[model samples]
Target: MRSVAAVLVVLGAAGATGALAQTPAPASPVPALDERVVVTGTAAPVSAGAVGRTLAIVTADDLQRLPVASVTDALRLLPGVWVRQRGPFGSQTDISIRGASFGQTLVLIDGVRVNDPQTGHHNGDLPVALEDIARIELLAGAGSSLHGADAVGGVINIITRREASAPTARLAAGQYDLVQGAVAWRPATMGVFQGASASVDRSSGFAPARDFVHQQVRADFRFGRTTLAVSHLDKDFGAAGYYGPAPSQEWTTQTLVAARHQRPLTGAWSVTGDAWYRTHGDEFLYDPRVLGARANEHRTHVVGGGLRVGGRLSSSLRLTTGVEATGDWLRSWSLGDREEARVSGFGELEARVGRLLLYPSARVDAYTTFGSAFSPSLAVALPVRPRVKWRASVGKAFRVPTFTERFYTDPNHRANEALRPEQGWTADTGLDTYLGGTWVATVTGFVRRERDVIDWVRPDATVRWRTENIRDVRSHGFEAFARGQAGPLALGAQYTFTRVETDRLAGLSKYVDDYAPHGVGGDVSLALPWRLSTAARLEHRRPYGREAWTTVDLRVSRPIRRVTAFVEMANVGDAQYQEIRGVAMPGRWARAGITVK
Candidate 1:
């Protein structure tokens, strides 16, 4: 099957060029390869067209064209990234990078860590309002050298509302009684200028059991060289018993405010610093019969700050160093847990000589309630040829045990306070080749080895769950993407292959890994005249021991002056399957919407 798929892909490419000498190929609309340069993945930014790993950048224009309601849904389209969906309304999304668990992935909003130290689950609950997003930069594989900690898998940096040269306001409405409105004011100032934005969204949802209502607000102010911002969000939904036997209900609210400043000390020297505070609260209620003891409430608070400085030591030597400290305090009334705090700091340096770039970074963390630990990383990228680049990196990263891992006690599982943090080392290598004005391709292979993997183990014949550190586990994967823009058309495709190995579990018979089987996907888009555009996506996944399924999605957009009309068709092929456990995904859903800017 794999061979057949590969052959078909090759044939398709050939057909796009010209099948035979008898027929002339149609003029392609895709842009030239020189335009594919990317800036991400390594300590020093490199163009996707130059060399490095498989990095994908989601531009503001891309966000405007797609018909997505949540950020998690948008992330699924990226190469080597997975979104574990618990429900349709963005209830609980577990994002995994390069097959790493949720906790191993680090998320940043304007360089601020949003991954709650309390639990990996809340990492996806992004504190920032999505409507205020300007751009999303995703770098796959270990990024501990550039970023610190929780980077075992990858890094996703979400750039929030920044100073724009123009002012913009947008209002949108969609099916399911969904309504959205946003406004932003940007001056023609260069830097250290003030800009602000605000957005709101609400939906009645599509499923009978799923309904959600949410509102988000954000504001930003800048004076001289300093900027301060604050955002608040509230989400209340009806989750009809998706987690337990009977219908369950949950409400979540989170607030975050941050302040940052940037200044230049002297020639070739600059300093930047930022501080943030966040609070999250979750309330859950389960059906009386099935949820025996699942109902509970949880809240968390996190505060931290960091400072970075950059300078040039010599003509060929450049260095960047930084120190960061974060402290977390979480309390759960329902679980009778009081407080858990951790503080951490890190430093990094980068040096470039000729065609080679080297980066080394280290971080040390101290937990007031736990122990202290250290993580170090190193990476190098070299230009093998004018159009070809080679890169590799090795890093150590860790994830602090979550509150649920240490305190939660329920009918199905019992928490263990002695749980230890999960630590891992990642090694990766890749090649990026630019084919002049034709095309650019990137390929990467990586392996992640983790010890003290936290998981639930069956303790008795009753199949009860108990928190324990698995002996050891490993995950290996490879990802590839080729992008080219020719004339009025853009063509791109990404493929990922992963394999996981672990000791067989001793439990009740018949347990599956609960992950997609064979994940491969690609997309194609066309830019037509008169401000019209069209796009298509082909996605395929095979679950363990189950027949693989393929689905196609289609989208069309047209702009008329200050207003745009968009139509989206999900699961155009009407394929039947489930992306997550016990959750039935929608099939062949259609939505039409409009946005005024």
Candidate 2:
């Protein structure tokens, strides 16, 4: 009743001021990447075409046509990235890029790191609501030279939606007693340009022991040159066969408090700084099917901050330098208590020479336990022709062992206290072709050589899995995209191919061999008369040591005055697959919803 009342109130308000609503931009899964500004690959802002790196951008316009309960739904349509879910609505999802392990990818909100120190499994616990996102930037290769550590694979940076669009509310209900609701307000007449959003999702279950609930509340405030944000996320879900071959349940919560500032100092120089604090709590029930099974509780606290000062040294050159500090503490029922700290200083220079652009960066990090490490990167972008650009980049990246890998243990698992850190070098080259807004295409290839790769392994299933640093591992992949619009029909397609190799321990390891070797996905949208539209997504994947599967999702929406009605069907093909062995996936799940703006 509350959800309905909220929607009705929003509808009434929207109807009373329908004429004042701003129309959104055209929807496209693949925007003009050549002109978009990306900050994920580098610490500073740079045009995607000039970054000389593989960067993927999902704009606000793209989110309009997506059937997204969480950002993972939208991310699934993109190439070079993999999103594996044990349940729907982001109950528990593992995210990786270009065949990197889940722990290798770094997740950030407005440049604040959100990667949990407890385990990479909790890295996807984003506190910000999906409706509050303005854009998502993904850098597909090494990023540690700029982002510190745990960026061995890539980086994902989510930029929030701050511009006033409209006060909106949404309510949805669907399969398995699913229910969802969200509301956002960004008043045009505000004292300090404030925005707030709250959302929730609940599902009884597709099957027994598979129920889930997710809730989020966030607020943003901007005053002069400073911005502040606060957010909370709570999720409780059944984890049937997610961790092991047993029925289980997990509950997790996170709270984020962050602040950012940017100001002009003097002359052609400027300074920017940010600080953030986050707390996460988790309770995991291991195996309910087994008598005397145990449950573990964990509480984690993190604090991070950075200060950067930069300016235009010359018309052809730009310089930026910064220092960062981060610390994390974890208290666990079984793993005991532990803490770690790191401090780093970094610098970058962006220079232009004739038709060529150069980016060079370096960073040094001092760790409380592992001593010090150095990271460096260089990149170049060149305009080869009127409608073509060539780009390339080489960088060094690293990752430290998570507390779970180093200390956590149970009947089914054992920790290796003497675990070692992992480091890798990656290089990539790509070409972009564009012509106005009608058509755009991109092709990119990358390779990574890594050492001391970490993995949990056991000689046989009869023995408990143990954490070990495999001596050597290598990976290479390529991603391509072609997108265009003609008349009322818009089409976009992307494909990615990856291969991973491990020497000595080759092919026998338990989890490191599960990367997808081939993946292809695409989307099509058609505009119909009477403010109606339809969109469809088709994706195919072939896991390295697993079977291949394909799934298709479709959505249709119609606008009536100030309200929009939508129906979405996921896994329409009913593909039988699992992100992990023994896990179950939904088949042909459907939902219908209405949005008032």
Candidate 3:
């Protein structure tokens, strides 16, 4: 694997030199940024330009232009967001933001929370198909004031496509005996709009016990002011060295059903509500070929619902209030049967005074097991001049311990029932500027102080890993990015510097201190003649007390009539690195695919 990666890196460098030197003729003008309605940071759907918080938006067109296989792949391009994957193609993925742990981040699908109560490890196991995603909204910084628990770091919301213009199908094959197929359709019905999509992906092991199969299906219905959606995902993969150093195999399944409705009550008032149900199952074996070899099975179910009423209270003021309830239950042989319920109430006020916009929000959650908690936040945005803005925000957030951390028991690890919830306070400020009618630049600084942070630690190699509430941690970071488009070419670059201060403990830890202190990334895309296009991405990361690594990826595609063919080379520099310690990532690999619309 090391030799292959080294060779690919050399080839990639040479190819990049030639590609950068040759410039094609100017093709067309760059399109304006899409001003879509985003709902992740606020109580109601509002234009991204009107929000005061730090946010990033990824559109469907951007997904199509990039060589990405999953939502995790697309998120890595954004600033302040980290995606750690144990395997390729969305296998065992975890997301973090602004130096937060995996459990501190929250994920949602169309306003419905999907974070599993059993563990944060499965939070990225989304049921929605990739082709059905319309857009992704990433809200950085504290969001617990609006999203309740598990929103201490940030929020990632995946919005599904409500309508499709035409039927589309895609087929792909690649190294390691990979095969993938997907189909999507939107049908016109009487007084209703309907859509459906399905996909399947399978690959043989790149190494021993590394094979995987993934399947997904989605269906949607819309009429007047009501919408319904259903989705299911099943994944079974060889978990070679996924958990600890043992060769393991695992299977996971997820199902979700959701409904949403909206209606105008009067001239300035509207009512909105949504309800969803989700269930997940997992089966794990230390060794797939050996029967009864330290096997474990677990199942979890979550049901939640929310109702809200919001509208313009006056010409320059808006108000929104809502109530939410969630119930979670787990049935397992090792973790036992446990259930918990939570109810929350939240409200937000948005007022505009001259050139400054003010937003204040608060939420109170009552847990069946741990009493009540309150979160509050305030944000302000001011347009100092045309095409320039200044924003600042301060908030408090908290995360409840997962079931696995509190009750699970195994040979190598044991849970701690006395663990307490994690809490933190976060503040940030930033400036955004637009230059030359084509370029946009942003700079931001943030600080977070956390108390009673939960982590798994051990004193020595002979002892079991136990969960504990460690000491206070202070994290601070600075981030900057510049992006622009001119004629047929678009380019962007970003950098981040983060530092962590924590009281030293006696032994090794799982996730409290592992982070990339210095990171740099960039992307470039060009349009050529004959309906051809190319894109390249570069990423570099330096972890504290660890070796640094860099990687490069390139993609080229051409469209003819209704068909588009593309080729992608990933990890061209095949750097010897691991997102998760001890898990060996694949080296350089290539794939080809065709899509028809």
What is the Cα-based lDDT of residue 221 in candidate 3?
Answer: 80
All-Cα superposition RMSD per candidate: 7.6, 11.2, 9.5
Deviation from truth (RMSD, Å), model 2: 11.2
Error of 3 at 406 (Å): 0.3
Scored against the true structure, residue 305 in model 2 reaches a CA lDDT of 91
lDDT measured at residue 62 in model 3 versus the true structure, 0 to 100: 66
Candidate 3 has a TM-score of: 0.92
Against the reference, the lDDT scores of all candidates come to 0.67, 0.82, 0.82
Report the lDDT tens digits of candidate 2 across residue range 1-597: 223323433443343233223423223212344667677877678766667667777776667775565777767756688898878888877888888899999988888888898988888888877688888888888898888888888988888887886889999999999999999998877877598999999999998889999999998888888999999999999988787666789999999999999998888888998999999999999777778877899999999899999988898788999999988999998878998899999999988765567789999999997888898987766655556666677788999999999997878789898888898988877777886674768888777888888888887777888899975877888899876678778777999999998876523465677799899988888989988999888888898868999998888999999999999998998888887556878888999999999
* Candidate 3 structure quality by residue, lDDT tens digits, 1-597: 223323433443344334334533122111122245788878888765567777776667667777777767877777877788888888788888877888999999998888998899999898877788888888888899899888887889998887645899999899999998999987765356488899998899678888899999988888678888889999999889988666788899999999999999988899998889999998989876676576788899999889999999898799999999999999989899999999999999999865557789999999998788899888776554455556677788899999999998888899999888898888777766666534767787887888999999999999999999986888889989876678878877889888888889999888888888888888888999988999888888886777888878889999989999999988898778887777877888788999999
Stretches of model 1 off by over 4 angstroms after superposition: 1-54, 129-131, 165-175, 187-193, 288-295, 435-440, 459-461, 508-512, 529-531, 545-547
Model 2 scores what on Cα lDDT?
Answer: 0.82
The backbone clash count of each candidate, in order, is: 14, 0, 0
